[model samples]
Target: MKKRFARFKSGWSLNRIFHDVTGALFAPLLISLPVWADAQPIQTLTIMEYRAHLNSDQPTVRGMIKFADLVSEGSNGRLAVTVSGATVPGSPEDQIKALQEGGPHAPDMMLLVTPALRHVEPEFEIMDLPFVVHSDRQAHELLDGPVGRELMSRLESHGLVGLAWWENGFRQITTSGKSFIHATDLTDRPVRVIPEPAFVETFKALGATVVSLPYPQLYQALKSGRAEAQDNFASQILVGHLYDVQSTMTVTNHSYSAIAVVANSAVWRRLSVRDRNVLQHAAIEAGRYERDLIREQAKTDSAELAHHGMTVHSLSPTELARMEAMTEPVRQQFFRSYDPKILDLYRHQIGTRWITR
Candidate 1:
């Protein structure tokens, strides 16, 4: 009986049995490791803009495309970027609504102007005040500097992440029949103004009958004689082929305009630290690219407009000063429309000597 028992014990070693049991328990986990070790699914982000594919030469669209490229490269294959320029129809306000709500309808990003935000937060009108900044450097510094940063910070509450500012250049007046070499040329003229109160008021202050119209309808308004003149940048004039219809270009620079690259704040916050860094760095780099490109393009467009037989007029220092003085009363309206605190900041930044109560 002892010999039989010894044979049975030798047949079943405890360590061998334990090894078999442990291996069986962990077999499923070990076999499933390849699934865990595989790369994660890629995430995609879309950028919607009013202009891009319309005229790929335009810096606003080109810079945004470059931004998309930088982000894709920076994120490796883990992230993908889709730039849909000129995708959304209607006014920029329409796309802006999608941004504020965020979802399938809202794109992950887009380029916008101050007025779009002004409608959401009236403090933005501070920047819209005519002749708020004198030089290109001043505009860049104001929009990229402390004031810009503060304005951008406020966007967080509005479900937007204001990344950086791109240039739309200065807003100049274009006339269909007369050249605007002097401020009086604008007086009583039927000039088309954007659908903003400041624009309406500025033209009204110039003694012109304001022809309020959406951007899309401006060229037709000029052709049909509903409007005789409009104020905007060179790119826009070229965008609408207005030189073909408009006879003169006045470099009044009555107001400044910008294109800000903003993202859906909720989506922005969900990005990983590395991803956020990549996106932010890309945005800043792209903004600089657009700003520099527009500087050269503005010069080229003016020359091209002259080639097209449209007279390009520059404002003399004296003329500009007179215009600024003429518009001073309208600038003061900021006190009644926006926060007095922001008005003080804008006045300080723009070096406007007039004090607002």
Candidate 2:
């Protein structure tokens, strides 16, 4: 026994014994270290952005991309955003439906125009009303203030969470036959307007024979004489090559168009409060970037359109006033149809005197 004990002590010295004890004690912790390092798994989100023009320079598409980047970086890769464009099937309306359904195939978020949202919530039409918002600054004031918040809040009941208001710039008139010098110049012209009621009524009030055609069909319609004029943003005119078919562009700025960044309510609720906040802040920041891009592009587009041999005209103050007066009834009808509180909020933000009942 004495010989065996001496052999054991010689083989296992103090350092060896100490190292064995610590190694045994830390084995479980060392094995569990990886789990601790990845306590939170990364969440990947899908965003379906619909744009008639999906070019790399498209402001709204770029904005959506910026939003995705901001969300990913802000979350430190915890939230990953994958942006898919027109590749997603169906119209904007159909896409909204899919988003609401919420499945493996449904997108977590979508950017929808106000007109598309109008069917879900009619108050959305208020944004499309002619002459309601006169300038970019005024639009920003209305949307970034209480009026905008209230409008977005209405979507919550419909399983949507509105994050920010992006712009499509102001709508301008492009005509194939003649320059719209006076409100009456639009009279009896075959003008293509968005299928939205307000847009139809506004052009009708000016005496234009309004035609509602899908955006993709617009070029052919004008080319074939099926439609003579259309109202859209300068970017649309440039991107859609409307200048090729339409010879005149009038800077009507009749209506300010806004796109909403919305998320599926179910998806939004699943996110942590911290993650949601990150998305919200990112959306707003990216929206500002998009708006700046659109405004800058508008300035350049006018010159480009002129270069393309399309005459660009700015409506005289008198003609704009006449057009505004003609569309007043449409605005009133809208005011009467929607929630009074929303109307009041809009009036308050845009100046109560601007829209009197």
Candidate 3:
């Protein structure tokens, strides 16, 4: 069967069709279900995130905390969630492998980048195409709509259950000194890309010498001059202190970088009906909250980046158009990766949103 996803700038696969207020108002109600379980053992689930605990918590981290709280409350403490964001025990890759294994050794849930999920389900890469999603609104429609449900269904094949989409926000570009306002600026630049085909291919099309690396290794790559450029949300630049590594920030907003909150299918299936509703509902609500927080934080973080001596540039329509032109080939390559039905849905969703804009 064909899988699906929505293109989102906030790190995602979605098409935003519903009103923001609708999500906020009805989310709790949607999860409310008739109590069916009389007895259930208390269970503690581990939640893993890629970044270590920073001085300031990102909204994504905050959302995980919120999810944990709601689950405990809704389950009347029968379900407890423990969160781990540190890198000491293992890398994100290791954690993902563990979750996929899903016996006694796996995390119950993990918040992962959309690109990272692509490794398990290649169909997910459909949402990784650059410039496909024009705004966060469109992303929400795609994800919350049928397209997202289809993509989440694909997770079953990989031993995962996608709970909800969270935000990493629109990725911006950073360079050591040279800025890529236009494609030509990338000539000979060694850009650090997420370890994903879409990222590598996109940067190459824009004329960069690309290197793939783990998030932990990015700062050193820039500091040691092994790499001079990378992309991430503005908040990441501030919290990760990437400004110290790359002195220039351009609001390329080229592609979306989304993280998914997913559970091991085995664990999820073992949950009581009411508990499943509680956890999934809590995850969706937390995701919306996290997305809002990330958007708010980006405003202040960009200014802080400028104060910290990093040149921050927001793209004009002309330059954004240029970027789309440069990355056209990469988009085409991914366009054929989806079923015709998925593409048709994308066109109607994105095209409608575009006309309204």
Candidate 4:
């Protein structure tokens, strides 16, 4: 049966196509599937924060706060958030699993940075391409437009469902040993890259030896000289306090690092449509709050990092062109491997928006 089903490329799996249909057809012959219990009094909602290592609140945390308030106000106090800062789960993957379980140890939603979710939803790497999105406004256009919705739909196939988009700001490249002024400057250096394939490809194309690592270990890798540079948003470097060890911050815009508020499908299916609407609105409110905080803080954060003796470099247009060219291969590779509709959607919409401008 597995072999036969594997032959049908692009065909919907029987289980997916007829989950309810089969249940109804077989009702007479078998016991019914267990119905989920009524939602417990929604006194508190838990959000897992990865902020134990950082001293100050990051944009992601700020977004969570806004989301909680929106939910409480929208639900009129029936739903409230219980923020479990670094207490709920250790890693993004662990947090995702916790949401899937949906019980005493579960969260109704988990905020995941793109890399962690990339394994489950690789097509999202569209935005992860180096220098693909140049500004906050461009990022917003992509996320809220048709391309973003098309990418979000892939979450269901991977067992997670996307609720709303949140910002983490654009990634900047930083190195302790050297400054990245040109694409060739990356040659022969071991750069710490997010574990996502697109990131790995981007670095490799620029002539760097890419090391795939999780976010939690990156600063140590730099401090110990095991790696020379890393890429992340300004908020992460500041909140994670990576500037203490790294000396140079380059405005690379290598990728857009955003968070997705996602729910496990099983948990979502049990909620009433009314509850779902509340969740959706809360998520949008949180996303807006996050975007505003990031846009307002990034320039200030860069200046502050410089005040602390970290050398900052904004690339010239020629150098920026070099960096952008390095990512073309990654773009081609991704489009080849991803769904054609997803590729076309992005091209058409992103192109249309560009032309109008």
- Measured by lDDT, the strongest candidate is 2
Ten-residue stretch with the least lDDT total in model 3: 21-30
Tell me the deviation in Å of residue 240 in model 1. 0.5
> lDDT per residue, candidate 3, 134-239, as tens digits?
7888778877887677778888887889999886778888988767777578877899998778989998998889999977678888889999999888876776
* By lDDT: ranked, best first: 2, 1, 3, 4
**Per-model TM-score on C-alpha atoms:** 0.85, 0.87, 0.83, 0.82
RMSD of 1: 19.4
What's the candidate order when arranged by decreasing TM-score? 2, 1, 3, 4
Looking at model 2, residue 114 earns an lDDT score of 90
lDDT per residue, candidate 4, 1-357, as tens digits? Answer: 001111222543221111111111111111122122235465444564433333114566557667766776687656655443443335556656666667866666777767667666677767777766778888888788887787778887766678899877888889887798887898989999977678888889989888888876887888888889888877777756778888999987768876788877876777778777888899988899888888888879999998888999887789888887776777777767776776677777666321111
Is candidate 2 or 4 superior in TM-score? 2
| Tens-digit lDDT string for candidate 1 (141-163) | 88887778878888888888988
- Which 10 successive residues of model 4 have the least lDDT summed? 18-27
Question: What is candidate 4's TM-score against the reference?
Answer: 0.82
Report the lDDT tens digits of candidate 2 across residue range 1-357. Answer: 000111123543221111111111111100011112236776777665555335545787668768877886688767766655433355657767877888876778888889888888888888899998888999898889988899899889989999999989899998887788898898898989888798899999999999987677789899999899999998888777888899999998999899899999999999999999999999999999999999999989999999999999899999999998998888888888898888888877777755666
Give the TM-score comparing model 1 with the true structure, all chains together: 0.85
lDDT of 1 at 177: 80
Candidates 2 and 3 compared: the better one by TM-score is 2
Q: Better model by lDDT, 3 or 4?
A: 3
**Clash statistics: count for each candidate:** 0, 0, 18, 1
TM-score of 3: 0.83
lDDT of 4: 0.70
Clashing pairs in 2: none
lDDT winner between 1 and 2, please give it.
Answer: 2
